[model samples]
Target chain A: MTTELSLVADIGGTNTRLALSAAGVVLHDTVRRFQNEGRQLNDILDEYLAECCPDTKPHSACFALAGPISGDTGRMTNLAWTIHAPEIATRTSANRCILINDLQAQGYALPALAPDQLTPVLSAERDIRAPRLVVGLGTGYNAAFVLPIESGVLVPAAEAGHASLPAHTADGRKVVDWLLANLGQAQVEDALSGTGFAHIHAALHGEKATPPALLARCEDGEAKALKTLEVAIELLGGVVGDLALIFLPRGGIYLTGGFGQALTPWLRQPHLQTVFHDAFAAKGKISAIMQDFALSVIGDDFAALEGCALRVAQN
Target chain B: MTTELSLVADIGGTNTRLALSAAGVVLHDTVRRFQNEGRQLNDILDEYLAECCPDTKPHSACFALAGPISGDTGRMTNLAWTIHAPEIATRTSANRCILINDLQAQGYALPALAPDQLTPVLSAERDIRAPRLVVGLGTGYNAAFVLPIESGVLVPAAEAGHASLPAHTADGRKVVDWLLANLGQAQVEDALSGTGFAHIHAALHGEKATPPALLARCEDGEAKALKTLEVAIELLGGVVGDLALIFLPRGGIYLTGGFGQALTPWLRQPHLQTVFHDAFAAKGKISAIMQDFALSVIGDDFAALEGCALRVAQN
Candidate 1:
């Protein structure tokens, strides 16, 4: 085994995670998280390197950011950080550095994920050769299709979150209309993200509540909060079902992201599971084919680091 | 140059088009179309070969059919034809035979399309390396994404038409509601196909009118007919816009299928063009990126044959 080390980082709006990998495997012990706190990314990287790997320099590096990537540069969506590949290389003393979208990083981590890391929402026979999809429901909603080619995998970029929010039922349409009336547009992210949870709660209960607050209310047996959660799950099911038809991700559909992880218990509830599956499989003619797709929630928080490591190794 | 001949065919519900190709270039002079009149596909192929190219035998063949292809066999959506590759090889006296979806054939045809064969709806600088998309709006609605790989292009299968119909405007939502009430489901095809024209007409006017009759009314300067056409165009624009965001088809979006071709003149009109563009670019924050995708209507009826020829040569 080679002793050469590579650095990988996943940069989000509020925090940045840095980890060291050897032979494309992330070193969990060396993983470290830092709060953004308006600090420069360079300063954070310097501190992480000085503290985590005092005597070692990485040979290569990859950073996955929460915003769009054009060519070799990335901008954080909610922060004032502009990440450039050359700057990352210079700061980390790495020979090769790459930047990819955070969603793409999640996509790359799919094939490397262990079975225990996934909580099954819908278990079906897996077609290992078919494409897989990673749906991110976090601060913002988005998805990436993982195409398995002969060489490795191709994770194509998509702005599906900005697409229109689809409504099939009366309740769904009411929520969509609420989105249109209040947000001035009806987009998937407008109703499926963290803020989307608040929007749904406001739309249903005529009041404001944060996502965590709504969860607390649901724990307190609040009917409106429970209804909000059910509606959100159904919307997710419908959106994911539409994506399944488009991408035909027969390998699996892996739900990832902070908000997605938080909803795992609710998603696992038998009644809510049916709510999702019904909305998902409600296609008119070809609904039967929906059974071929297996759905799971990715429980691994370090999957993006794993993905960045994989990308660095591939390059 | 080798004088080896290859066979290519595009099989639709009503007609079957067959042609000969040499060196991956379709021979327009050898192209022939036969109406199905309740004839078997095998008999049609026999008659086509006997009439069109009696002197030459194709060394290989490819057929693009309007239906699902599982493995080496393809089942036609409208016709009672099961196209098995081995059977086709035996019937055509070809050593190799391949079957692909009709939309995929359209996808492969993109790179080889002549400028004269396409009419620009929204022209922009083409990104030669980016992915392309083919959206079909005929008897049924669907889209296929064309990924430009190192070797060739990969057109992934998609059943987008069977997904939910997205509505952002009052008029659009009304149409969606009508589709849901009438069809028990609101799918993209329910509002975007040949039959969808009739559905929109009925939804708006509360009267029955065939697609052709409605078109004639529009040509005759009927108000309701024009409104129906405009509404359908706007719906198409919205659906295509959503798809554009998801697929990021920077190369271009090529509108194919019979109904789409028929809508070209109206789509090109200045006022209607604005309507389409308005609906297509109405995505809230990311609306600007929609301008990056060029939209065009494919005018050539035999482009699928050209695609089959390309596929045959590729294999």
Candidate 2:
């Protein structure tokens, strides 16, 4: 007798990862990555199924997309792809299909991730029943609030990166003014994303540099590069702190995405760590309560796929 | 045979309003108000019970407090009263009791409010199935996000008032700088609450004036007073817009509390209304999406009591 498999995929800007799971456990060996290039998502999925399981019709399918999902449809942020649940179900010959935001997928995977896959930024007692928050910092920024319900968890989508950056100190205001003048709008994503790092560097030094080049300069103890990192870290801390108050994520905050992972090492440095904690905990009377929230980084690349599998299983 | 009634109360700083409900409907005739006058919450509850339901034991009880709630315990923000749910349950002879923030109560009361009770600030399409937000601007500032679940609506507590103020324009930053210099922190409450009105008045004109006094001056065509009102409304709009992005409350954004009510007339003024809307929809790329959120003022005085009754009935 053959076991019924469920198909899950994570669709990003340049790559798409496809995997199969039985009962909710991902078949790690069956996972494969394919370049999006300029082909449609349906074509990629057809190729993936043909190569992996030609004769087997999956029981269910779920796709986690790096963009907004409205009803049963989703549009990719970086690529020219529009995903419809009904189309995917028809293409995969699956019983049911669903689409969710990538950040939400990260939120659902939080409960299933092992300790070795997460690195703690701040250690605190976590209330298992409380809500968790997943913050994504990549080509673009967004967040998802993971609410634990009796049946399962509910991950609500948020467009926080498009909101105005929170400015406290005079220096912060100066950066905000610079962003307003240069970018025409001072949004959180303008200063906290991968390209945001470059913007901050440009704002301070009036020179263009990629995030990698700036990171290398910081490693060499360059004062300007170090200041850029400090500004970005402090801004991130302030934004995350504001989010914590809004969401009350006592289950802890998990940072994900390429930019977030890249900043993990810099976030661990003694001086930058202090800057982050201070900005995060500087909410006047509620500063003490803010300290109760633990922070961590999700290092698993397949977490979103796992999240998609878990979502399919829950159905 | 005596009918089993549910005891519900809205405990504010200066006054405590108590009422009895039956079958999820609040008995309007049983509603009574008593001045706290340095009295404990238990004492007020005892007197209310003695006067309203002398010969009967309540089946359940719920209190809506003007403060934070941790588990079943709550402390009044502007009054020295601590409420413990177990104590209230025992005193009222109720099977169980729950404590929730007043903003949360407003959130719960949204569905129960009549059309006449809500005056629209910004008329737009509302998705009833989507989340709603209640923002309180009275003695203190806070918000509650009302998520529609299968069982009932879940109103999550938020301390968004303590978050840093979002400033975009140079003039707004100047006001923020003033708040940072004089108030030691530039929080949302520093420029959006009842006292914050006076702070803005003082910041612009370097004069001490009450919120009411400022309003009267604005009516009398005082430029500084009008400017103060403009600043407050713009700040409120910017903050609410940021919140809309974060919560994605497509259901609606409800403004409650005394200060919010006072600002309703001012928000209706043509020029000030323009100021408010412009500041609110100023979010760059996602500015158009902000227009979809319907803004309204909750004018019901007994909404919190009704919310308490609803909570008891849900139990």
Candidate 3:
């Protein structure tokens, strides 16, 4: 049997990973790291192709660029790349070049992920036919929701990160107000992202506090660091509850992205579920029917890459 | 063409509207406005059918209820009515029966509504191809979101009203705290529904303010009443914004229900724009993309009735 190779690129803020595969099955796939901080996208692309697939005419390429991919011309928030699909297709000499939201790429990996990839955090054993929400907590918070339909699969792009964070406590309200005073807007992403952790830790542990340092201290079981993480996870779980109420993800909730990875280890802490169920327990409305839903974290790997491959298979 | 007549019901808290239609045209439709508050669903159905449909041996009937139609059993929050298709079929002697969400019934009306039936509030307008959001604000706040797919439509039940409201102001923060103290939970519906209005009015104008008087004063534009409505619209807009950001409504935001009818008059208020815009603007993530969306009131009369007719026509 003969196999054809296609190109796949997972475009991130700091690095650009390009690989070659056949029908989404990676074969001789490789990457070429670039300093997108300084160079042009074309320069990076030329270097990647030369190193990975020289003298080979690939069928097509799928570009999963970070930031918002609203239309044909997608611009990166952190990097200097303003990507155009048609333009990239011509430049790469490929048959097609499609762009999807990075979170959507993550959504594609929802089913591809195995039990080993996902560690059960707050298990609800949700209904299989129910819609599952894919929340990404990275440099920013975003969500991509998927529902099983009579048709096949449905993925809706979600900007839930900007949706207001529920302020249940006085301290929660204080964090909201403080973040608003500093950033002009109080949002879940502003309070739950890595930068959000730094902001909260800095407020508690002075200006020198950072997300990495806080995580390290929390690893050491530092009380103050643990407190900060508890509050962050509490807020994060609260938002997940809010999202679940809004979407009613019968398929269960899957958390992803870099921040999701960081928060994974801390999910089992008792205080997290306390805040989660507290917020989720809405009364006098659809609260009673809010059963059969639980939160879980997606297995860490190249979910985005797997998602991109999934999209190729789907399209 | 000789046509067959079927049973159709718009089951609500207070009354049930039953109609007999042939070839998707109503032959006889009347409201059997029975108080569902005191009676069992079976008793109400028995009483409702005896008066409404005397002589109809139809094939299939679709009952649009105001609750999650996850499976055979359906439960409504505002009333004591739980319906099952098989149960209704056995009693009514029907071939097939469906109990779908009321908002979903309204969603089926999306493709049928005329341009004149909509009163456009926002300016730019929506893409129409993207999934449209259908929101209901009547006896209580609830929502039913429908996703458009290539094969057909995917209507997902969302207790979106129970989603937490994000408070931005000191006044709002105080309100959030008060809700937590008094109501034990601070979900959005706790502040934005019909009951929520009563709570907001009480919170704003002491414990003595009544819904009838407050609504009347609001209608008369009395200062306090107007202020209450202002907060109501702002809170309403905030939730609308939340929904907009969640789905990025490409088909536009269709606000329905009696509450929507009340809000129709105040659609262009400055507070409405501020609260709604703040929900999207805070992200600075999908802000530009959001500008393309517009808000509108679904003004079609008896939309649920018309929706029932549509089901007959298409099915």
Candidate 4:
């Protein structure tokens, strides 16, 4: 049953992060990352196993992927690799293998996160039994809601980021209208992701700039860039608030993604919280429900891997 | 453990509907409705029991309420009645008493609904294991997501109607803006309920009219009233589509509530279906997910009572 050792992997579009763990606890020293340069997942697993466990093979394996997993197979949304759990188990000579969506993996990892691994942006009572939401703002954006149940937690698959972005202010409305005209739809991803920085920058200042350059410009006190970040943060707050009301995630709202991790400091500031509270406060009962939610950002990069280990341990 | 007989009630702001049941199956002949003019829920229950079950006392009771139930007590959202499950158990001489939110009761009833009780508005595959959404567009609007779990089902408390409404088209944006300016926020309830008809009528024609009157005018082929109905239906479609993307309720989208049932004919037409698809078609995967969902309008008015009985039976 893989009680002592298990192999866990978090497979993204560009890279795969792998680790060995015991009872869902990842061994930090055994962690490895591999780039997906036209290599199958089975090959990566073999390489990781040979390097990390030379004496004994892992008893089981569990994988988290940046794609949808149906039945025994998973197909990456951006990458070309197709993953099959049973096939991986056979190829790795493991007793069992399980695959789940990366967001669900992140959702599963929420309970195991240490205090140091999470930075709470909105401090409030944390009810462990309530639903918890994970909103990822990276290359593209998405979210997953983890529900605590009797037998096990249920992580409902969410495509919230693809839902249209809502405008909360006059300026926000103008920007959203312009995005809808130019992009055919004002998706939440259009305003809350790395690529979204370009849209915000272009909307604020009549030109496009890469997110890194934009962040650098803002750090140098560029007025236009600063406004762009404020607007982006405002949009992110609005979406998070909407989700809070929709899901009532009294457990917490976890922002997890490369972009979200980079904006940890900004997210913790009063401006984002103020905008978030204001958005939900437009409705009375929903306002109270949202105000009690604990908001945080994931500080650990290997959360998905940890979650995969957790699932493997559970199985 | 009342295995043979149970008393179930659906208590709303204006009235209470009570019935006797055996093993979660409601006895239609025993169903009774009482006005809630100035009395408490206990009083109404006492009167109902005295009238219907004078021969014997029910062994268990479950009540579906119009407000949030915290701990053992429930306070009505709009009415003055406050109900305690334990108190009801003591007063009614029942072995067990369970109190659940009305929307959750409706959600619990989803599995028991007959084919004739559900009008399929958007036809697609129905995966009973997936989450199902119940959106109430009656006097006051709200939604509940009924998630299928291993043990039973988990219907997380939802106040989704208060969430800000999203605009999909330029016309939708204009209506939403006007609504926001007039009502402080463009809540889904503002444009998807009975009161929404007056606002839509005033927006379309320069005057306000009752919902029934507006529906009558639309039936008589009045252009302005027809247009108002069209906009309201469009807004409902957009909200449903947004929820579909947010929750990915592959089990189905159930449109319950008085207004929704009354609009069943229009809701089943191609226009609402087209708008709903268009609202979700802004994103690729979300569009596909939404297209695969089953959308229906619930036809049962006593579904909440049935759900209460179901909860009692489960307990």
Candidate 3 residue runs with Cα over 4 Å from true position:
A1-5, A24-35, A47-56, A204-208, A271-291, B1-6, B20-56, B269-287, B308-315
Model 3, B53-107: lDDT tens digits are: 6665556677888766768888875676678889888887778887777877887
Clashing pairs in 2: none
Off by over 4 Å in 1: A1-4, A51-57, B1-5, B49-57
Better of 1 and 3 by DockQ: 1
TM-score list, all predictions: 0.96, 0.97, 0.90, 0.95
Clashing pairs in 1: none
lDDT of 2 by residue, A187-238 (tens): 9999889999998888877889999999899899999999999999999999
DockQ of each: 0.79, 0.78, 0.61, 0.65
- Mark the 10 consecutive residues where model 4 chain A has the least summed lDDT: A277-286
lDDT by residue (B1-315, candidate 2, tens digit) is 865699999999889999999867899999999899967777888898898888888899889999888888998888887889999999889999988889988988887899999988998899999998899999778888888888778887778898888888666777787888897888898888999898887777789999988889988999889988998999899999998888889999999999999999989889988999999899997898898899999999999999888777765
Candidate 2 segments whose C-alpha is farther than 4 A from its true place? A1-4, B1-4
For each candidate, what is the lDDT?
A: 0.90, 0.89, 0.73, 0.81
Residue B66 shift from truth in candidate 2, angstroms: 1.2
Model 3: clashing residue pairs?
Answer: A117-A299, A130-A251
What candidate 4 gets wrong by more than 4 Å, as runs, is A1-4, A54-57, A271-273, B1-4, B55-57, B280-285
Predicted candidate 1 versus true structure: per-residue lDDT over A106-166, tens digit per residue: 9999978999999999989988988999999999999998998767788878888999898
lDDT of 3: 0.73
How does candidate 3 fare on TM-score? 0.90
Candidate 4 lDDT over B1-315, as tens digits, reads 534789999998888999999977899999999988977777887888889888888999989988877668988887878898899999888888888889889998887899999898788988878889999877778889888876567788777777777776656776777786787677777778888777767765658799999889878989888788777877777677778878888888899988989888876668755655565454644466667778888999899998887777765
